[model samples]
Target: MPSLNPASRERVLVLLRHARAESWGETDHDRHLADEGRADAGAAGRWLAEQGLVPDHALVSSATRTQETWQSLAEAAGWSLEPQLDDGLYSAGPDTVLDLVRGTSSEARTLVVIGHNPTVAYLAQMLDDGDGDPTAAADMVMGYPTCALTVLTFDGDWSALDLASATVTAFHVGRA
Candidate 1:
């Protein structure tokens, strides 16, 4: 994890929904990303880099598509951190995912979570404090399609994060 100034109280949380996946796999958890998904993931990464929102740490679902999305995105973004893959994330709800976020280390100022929707989408909406960029929030309301991501800023520790505790700063749907 990239070390941050301990005195800084603000933290960035990125919620990402995994890109499109092939439908013919034996199981959903084992399904891999489609060609379009790979391209979209790369696009998402480049966009994030341009925004200077590189994450210090990442939490990803153990499902193959989510793992592949993270790998492609990280490679395109030139990020060199190892992501934590949690099997529970494959089926976790918004509250379960929020609990996982709360367990994040304080050393990480920017964290990313890659998982499935509507969990990811719901979490992003749940965190909004109604004080962020109105345009971004409006865009998010349209729907969280494949490779969609939301950037939120919060004050205090990750453990203190809750509904309406964070402000949605940006929202985008990466496509290629």
Candidate 2:
């Protein structure tokens, strides 16, 4: 956990959906990212660097595809942060995801979470306070494509995270 400043009001939560993965006839959890997925993951990382949003901590799903996505992103961004891989995030719902986020250490100001769809997309929709980029919000309504990254800002502690409590700062789909 990073050192916390009580006076710091802004916290960043970056929700990233795993990149496109191949079926490979393997179990859902065992599938890995496709070549395109790898490229997109790297692109996502580059975009994060361009935004100057470096995560102080990261929570990633245990699924193979998610892990691969994280690895690709890290390599591309030249980031070297050890992320916690949890099975609970594999098929978790939006509520569960929210709970996990709320449980994060307050010492961490920026947190990046990588997970599967539906849940990831659902979390973003539920948390946005409607004061963000209108175009991005509109694009999200259509769909949260593979490797999509949604950056959310909150002025409260992690324990206070809840539905509609964050302002959507940036929402980018696909590679930069």
Candidate number achieving the greatest TM-score relative to the actual structure: 1
RMSDs, each prediction? 3.3, 3.8
The candidate 2 region of ten consecutive residues with least summed lDDT is 1-10
Assess each prediction's global lDDT (C-alpha) against the native. Answer: 0.91, 0.87
The estimated TM-scores of all candidates read 0.95, 0.93
Model 2 spans > 4 angstroms off: 1-7
Error of 1 at 42 (Å): 0.2
Global Cα lDDT for candidate 1: 0.91
lDDT for each residue of candidate 1 in 1-176, tens digit (9 for 90 to 100)? 22222236889998999999998798979999999999999999998888887788899999999999999999989999899999999999999999999999987889999999999999999999999989889888789998999988888899899998988888988898
| lDDT per residue (tens digit) for residues 1-176 in model 2 | 12222236789999999999997846999999999999999999987876777788899999999999999998888889999999999989999999999999998888999998899999999999998877777777789999998888888889999899987777887563
Q: Cα miss at 14, model 1 (Å)?
A: 0.6
Q: What 10-residue stretch in candidate 1 is worst by lDDT?
A: 1-10
